[model samples]
Target: MNTSKNRRLVILMYPRVREMDVASVNDIFATANTILPENRRYQIACLSTVDAPQLDGMYGMGLRTGPLYSTFRGEIDTLIVPGGMGNELTEPPEKLLKWMRKQGSSARRVGSICTGAWLLAQAGLLDGRRATTHWNQAHLLARDFPKVTVDPDPIWVKDGNIYTSAGATSGIDLSLALLEEDHGRAVALEVARQLVVFLCRPGNQAQFSVALKEQKTENTPLADLQIWMQEHLAEDLSVPSLAQKAAMSERNFQRVFTREIGTPPSQYVERIRIEAVRRKLERSTQSMEEIASACGYGSADVMGRSFSRQLSITPGEYRSRFRSSGIMAEV
Candidate 1:
């Protein structure tokens, strides 16, 4: 991978970084290189934040890294920052931040994976740009950096040349998007097929939220009711109906459901219904009316409105963007 012929891509590494965030992004571009011509390939270099030949990743994995400053000269085509446990601590060294600030201008594009958005924020690169990070840390990023517009829904965001993505494999999604931008949709899709990953996930697709899955619930009735709600989406899920099914008064049911589930019953119902609708849109050949009926939406218009309100995308648009290509061709 010669810098003179290939596109130069630098990955900024730090101790305790999330290994997945780094490895997945690197793998996407590396896989692309195998398919692309020599002159069009990506020349990837991993540069360490600390002056160390090796760094221990967040999960105790050993990784070899090059010295940050000793690497190269001239403009970088792409500079990526990966998130990890390191970001939970205090701000990174001013020198590192300064270097990033400088490179942010020189690099054709700058991106952060997961919590790496924090490093970019600390350097003031994302101050006025719309960005996203892992859903878990998105609030902290927003609260800490009031100047940056933090959108927690999307799996990734591209506001100008600065890109940010959600947790874990979203880095791969971001890399694929960059690959498509550099080459074409066909090349990126082939790379994704070779890698055994999804061809491409649109940036605006909602992050896989663990809204109901991760919530704590100790009451047997509430737990049973939650499962029942999912299996019976088309049924009346209003507070009165659910309360009767739970053998409790409406007031008590609402209070207990909210306390146990970490969200009001109505809101939780909407979220799960939307999740169901999203799955159908992506995988099934069903029409909007069919999906709406199956997902318990009263009508296609109701489902579209729900999608718009919750995901900021209409059902038709979501299907077009996320429907599996093979499945899409059959339609």
Candidate 2:
């Protein structure tokens, strides 16, 4: 089989950087290297903006990073900027932003992991383009750089040769996509299996999970009801049923639930059911009818509409894209 040409992957690191963001991208490419011939492997480097030989990272870890000056003029196939806690406290050095713009212009592709998108925006590299970062920090990115369109929903966003991924693990998904582009799906799948991650999440996948979003409800009754809803998905979850369970009138329950949860009770129940259906599809051999019934849908068709409404993809399509080899083995 023919493989693509070797590519140079450069990671730009800084003090207080999230170690996972840097490591995830590096590991994906490194794992791919173990499966590829020398001529087609990625050339990886971790460089720091500071002149120091060692840099402090988040969670009390120290990283050994090469000074950026050493490779300022070298050819770069792909340049990656990783997000850091420092992004919240201080701006990156002017020198680094200058270098980033230069590298971003020349490299075949440039990308960011998490808040690393901040640096790209600061460098004016993301001006007038769509991008995403860790969802928690997504608002700040958009507020600080109004010129850049920020979409917080996706695991990643790619515009032309620039890529930006949400959070740290999304970096893994981004790297796998890049690997698949350079090599093939088979090579990427092998690396994913070795790493024990989903093969590769699509760029448009939601950044946050349904469970995480549901946990944000502060109202005690609503919070308890959210948990109950998950456990009783197959049961009736209409406002009247939920209201009766909460011991409140249906009118009052609807008002309070919408105010506290930011979504109506019915919508929240649908989200929970869809999440359940998604997991079943990814990990089990259960037929669509079984999954739909278990997850509280009236039927497969009812479940399919809800899944497509939120995910823009149908249940069967989601299963085909995400059902891994391990799960297929069980069948």
Candidate 3:
């Protein structure tokens, strides 16, 4: 690729970085360049510690990376750090941490994927900033770095010049957002299409899937109750109703559901309803009233409040930002 006008995007690699995290983000930018007619594209580079000439990723893939000293040249416009098993260590290599502190201070934008947020926190780049990491590691990150506010829900987050994402695939989501910022929504959407992903997911979208949340525990009664609730979303799902379905008293059912599902029964139902509403809003052009009714919110006004409370976006705004263009035309 031509380097003259291209923006420099350096991906900092470390031992045991997740291959998917690194490759997915790189592929998004690389693919964007191929699809865009513009001559200037993002120029990507892989860099590692001086002692580690060849970096080995989580999946045993070996990548030859430039020495950390190369980053001191200050040509980096964007810096991305990918995460993996290495982040579990209490202390990262001192040399790499120093390089991150320097590059992150000078780079136009700095970001991390998955557990990479931990590294950013260690480098003091994310202190007092809203950030996220893989859902499984979010608590640990917060515990390790009290100054950073860790939100485990978002697929990605942009706090000023810093960005962080939830997991491996979420790295692609963060990169697409960066592409949108650098290029435009049209270019990002085209890249998403070329990659055969659904249109770029909004950064605010939850990283956890509905299915994953519902199946988090192996309690057969609770599992069956969850299925019943999903199917009967439009019906009454109050504490008494759900308790009856689960063949338990209301108090007992509430306790078990909360313990297993990691959320109260009422809250769980609300999330399911919101997720259903979101799907309909993105896929169908139905009136808000119709969608609200179908999704068990009773009315558009009620659903509007739920959307604002849970997603910090109105139903109309969510549809405008996330509705697939092709689906919109068909609707």
Candidates' lDDT values, in order? 0.84, 0.83, 0.82
Q: Is candidate 1 or candidate 3 better by TM-score?
A: 3
Record all residue pairs in model 3 with backbone atoms less than 3 Å apart, i.e. clashing: none
Candidate 2 residues lying further than 4 Å off, grouped into runs, are 70-73, 217-265, 275-294, 304-331
Report the CA-based lDDT of candidate 3 relative to the real structure: 0.82
| Model 2 TM-score (2 dp) | 0.78
Candidate 2, residues 1-331, lDDT tens digits: the string is: 2355788889988888899988898899999999999999998988878778888898769999885654556788899988788684477678778888988889989999998898899999999999999998889899999999999998888898899999988888888878877887678778889998854566766787686776787788888888888888899888888999999999999998888888888888888888888778776789999999999988999999989999899999988877641222211
- Candidate 1 residues 1-331, lDDT tens each? 1224577898988889999988998898999999888888888988888788899998999999886654556568899999899595567889888888988898889999999999999999998999999988999999999999999989899988899999998898889878877887678778788888843566766777444463568888888888888889999999999999999999998898888888888999999899888777876689999999988988999999989999798989988877632221111
How large an RMSD does model 2 have? Answer: 4.6
Please list all clashing residue pairs in model 1, or write none if there are none: none
Off by over 4 Å in 1: 1-5, 193-200, 210-214, 218-259, 263-267, 278-286, 305-331
Per-candidate Cα RMSD to the true structure, in Å, reads: 4.9, 4.6, 4.9
What is residue 107's positional error in candidate 2, in angstroms? 1.0
